[model samples]
Target: MKTIPTLSLALIGALSLSACQDKTAAPEDIRPVRYAVAGGNAETGGARYAGEIRARNETQLAFRVGGKVVAKLVNSGEHVKKGQPLARLDPSDYQLDLAAKQAQLAAAQSDLAQQQLNLKRYHELLAKQFISQAQVDAQQNGVNAAQAKANQARAVLDASRNQTGYATLTADADGVVSQMQAEPGLVVAAGQPVARLSQDGAREVAIQVPENALEAVRAASSLRVTLWKGGAPLPGKLRELAADADPATRTYPARIALPGDSHGLQLGMTADVALPAQASRQLSLPLTAILDLQGKHYVWVVDDKTLRVSRKAVEVGAIDSDNAAIASGVRAGDKIVTAGVHLLHEQQRVKLLGQ
Candidate 1:
């Protein structure tokens, strides 16, 4: 019984020693801390918009007469000058018709010549009393009839020639061939588009603006367009605003004319546009500072006194080439985590790198 009491005393002494060791352990060993620096506000200028580049004029090249295509001289993306032959239909039928009309014209001319001679002879005979007045009148009528037939034949010849010319499709303007819908041996109808041509001229950036954003866009006086390829921003003027919104997207179409030569620009190229909202001093930050969880967007901000992280929900406005505009949720003098936000949580302690 005395041995059991001694063993119990020993166990109690060991438990007290373990409690003292736990109190002496370093706090850093229990929870590790990381340092994060706050991001400084960046100056933002305007709202950046994205849109597609388009040519000022586009046309469809098609044959004027229906026939089987004999040859397609041009392909898509081929640059063609005005009057260049784009395609040709079979002209054999048209050529035969023209030949037939020519032959008829020749016969009509011979008949007209014969009628003229007869009418002259009749006039001379009537002058000498060799023919009666009725005979001369009949001869004159015959001459008029022959002349009318000659005129009809001439018209038919001209029409046949025109039809022959119509077999060849030509470009109406200098442009790049954007599409080719027909090939050799394909039978195409008159006025059916065989190719699409995009005329070279002033280029515009076409953008679809949400209906709710139209008021703000109209209120702005000017906007700047930045080519994705990088250079000086081209000054833009609002040329047109659609009267109605698109039924499918519920957005209004807006077009901006870009000043300067658009020689290098091509259709479907993407461009970035910047529109200035009300000019006011606001806090802007790099896009890296923004974070997303589920569908909500937030930013990690540093507490001035505790040096701990605070998650703040922010309303983001527009994004430009480098930064994003913060409409709400952040203010000046607040230090925002610029990097390593993925490793942070609410109320997490952090040590400043420099401090």
Candidate 2:
């Protein structure tokens, strides 16, 4: 009777332990992943860059000769017609030089006339046998030498006149004065910029693009310019891009040429240049979402209904802001695992954390 009771207690304890193990087992561990929808951030519409209005042609106005500045006829922001005087140098010195050149020219002409008269008289003397043929030839040579001196003096006088004209700086074309480098009483060298002229023509938008965004800017399919003063955007095209980046900011300088006859466009106005995003299927995601394995790029895409993650290969394109553009192999509205991509496996069931 004691053995039977002891065996029965052991059997009941074993059954109880089995029942507890079946009732209270550890739960299955599922990984929670951070994910983001494609086509978000800077990829939705376009990428914008801060820009400024500018003229297509900016010319540095300078004098052809060095002189002391006597007057500045036009101030910065003033518009002038072609050949309009912008500044003037002291013409007194140039006038004096012109007078001296005139005097020299008169003296040369007098000498030339005297030589011609002497040559004519020598010819008559030689005909009468009063002078040798060699003497007449020598007088002819002296006349030729005097003629050359007169020609040289005439050229010098013409040059002096041109220099006098150069003393007055004038605009070569119709333009607005953008900057003034010379002031009254300032002596400037020849070819030194006296003022900057912004010629009236096609306008352009200038912007600085960061190093990483250069490719996106270059590959932009379409571009538009929006003024900061609130107006409709104007169509634009890429006109210039710097080959190397700036040393201080590490940015590439770019210029977008606008159409001719840009009304309401003013110089130095702030603007925004828009580089439209790629076509409808283009998607962009964070760098963490892209996995590089075996020299290829991949992203973990989650199925909305099942919440199961699968590795999918994607083609990457130019960088747009902080996101990498997906050229192909991805579509809009797909949920991509944005963090801890390395730990994911194919067909892994995942739970998303609140974004």
Score each candidate by Cα lDDT: 0.82, 0.89
lDDT of 2 at 118: 99
Which pairs of residues clash in candidate 1, taking residues 3 or more apart in a chain or in different chains? none
Task: In candidate 2, list every pair of residues with a backbone clash.
Answer: none
Candidate 2, residues 300-333, lDDT tens digits: the string is 9999999999999999975655678888988888
Listed in order, each prediction's TM-score against the native is 0.70, 0.70
Question: Poorest 10 consecutive residues of model 2 by lDDT?
Answer: 38-47
Q: Tally clashes: model 1.
A: 0
